[model samples]
Target: MIILRTPRLTAHLAVAALFGSSLLLASCADADTTSNTSSVSSSASDSPTSPVSDSSAEGTGAGNGGTDSGASMLPSGSSSSADEAGQGVGGNASETEEAPKTSDEAVSEAVNRVNRDYPNKFGGWVFKGDTNFDSAADLTYAKVEQAQQGNAQYETLLIFFHKGEYLGIDSTYPQQVVSTAPSSRGLEVVYKDWEALRDSGDANAAAGKYTSTVTYYWDGAQVQHEGRIPNTGL
Candidate 1:
């Protein structure tokens, strides 16, 4: 069964029946919110054009069952060697490489984009307008609603954007799974392993732990995930 990966998600939801494998981005604490999915696939054309609620099961909804898969928890034989964690299909070395840097204005612009475009179907979540990527942080910052924070309704989520495109809402408190982007910094996978039990770790974390990780290249408008992992992760 497919599920939505959520932040601060309980073990019950994270350990749900595992089907196909993939990551599903969740509401990071910086903002606050949550999906699980067997596989997730998104593109620039798939990007939302209007404000979407977390409760809706439309294109930007976390409840989408697209059956598209993203990167796996760990590559095959990852247990034997820790060097295979971020080596997913089409993994980009340039993304993980060093670049000039992002200016405060650029970060602010990314935050504005998320506010106007980022999906907020989840309850209690409101666009606070912030970016978590500090001078090139992995995610932008924005506040979304959620039941865990005493919000009204609740739901899962999957955010796929470029390194600057991602926003880290609020990290004041702990939730299910923390929003994580692809290993762009080239972090060593010393102890990479499944976040679930035996074979369940490969399942989606929407209903439980944070899932989904979006990374794409942008050239003024064309968003593509070519040679990159699917649009989902921890």
Candidate 2:
């Protein structure tokens, strides 16, 4: 259609056309941005968070139940023999070697060793620490007494040892009392022979005083009789 074209209308029409072209370009750019965003979201949702093989996932699920299992799937304290062996390896001296035994432990071990090796050899003897009547000696000496049932008289034996090795025994005669003391070089044992007083006419003479006194000393190798003193009167 042939229409009148005014200068002002022509300039207005040109400005409108330019504005329309600008809006169309902006709308196309927005649509392209939305499509790209939607495509990226779809790709993210389809892909797995972590890359893992199907076989690996199945094996893990079979043993550990799922991908996010608890501490049960982790290694325990005694998990493997290799782990236990590793604990004692290297410079783990505390785990490899045992702790040093205490004095009480050594005494108990010595007593048990003697009892187990020589069962009933000491005549049903009772250990020193086991009874109030008996006296306790140092670790180097163990004093044991023959079990005194109803009688007041029993034999006592002094066992000598050097660092857990059994040396020898010094025993008192029946109806005699024996005592021990630590000497400068070794140990001293004194025996009171009251059996000689049994023949005395006095009823309480035997229990009142001993008839003789004998001293013995341990000179490392063996126990030697030092000397003897006799009591003439009770």
The top-ranked prediction according to lDDT is: 2
Whole-model alpha-carbon lDDT for candidate 2:
0.44
Candidate 2: RMSD to truth: 27.0
Clashes counted in candidate 2 amount to 0
Candidate 2 local Cα displacement, residue 108, angstroms:
3.7
How big is the positional error of residue 121 in model 2, measured in Å on the Cα after superposition? 10
Residue-wise C-alpha lDDT for candidate 2, range 155-224, written one tens digit per residue: 5555444333343343322423455565664444455555455555545435545543334333433334
Model 2 weakest 10-residue run by lDDT:
54-63
lDDT of 1 by residue, 46-88 (tens): 5444332222111222111123232321111101111112333
lDDT of each: 0.31, 0.44
- Quick one: best TM-score, which candidate? 2
Worst 10 residues of 1 by lDDT: 73-82
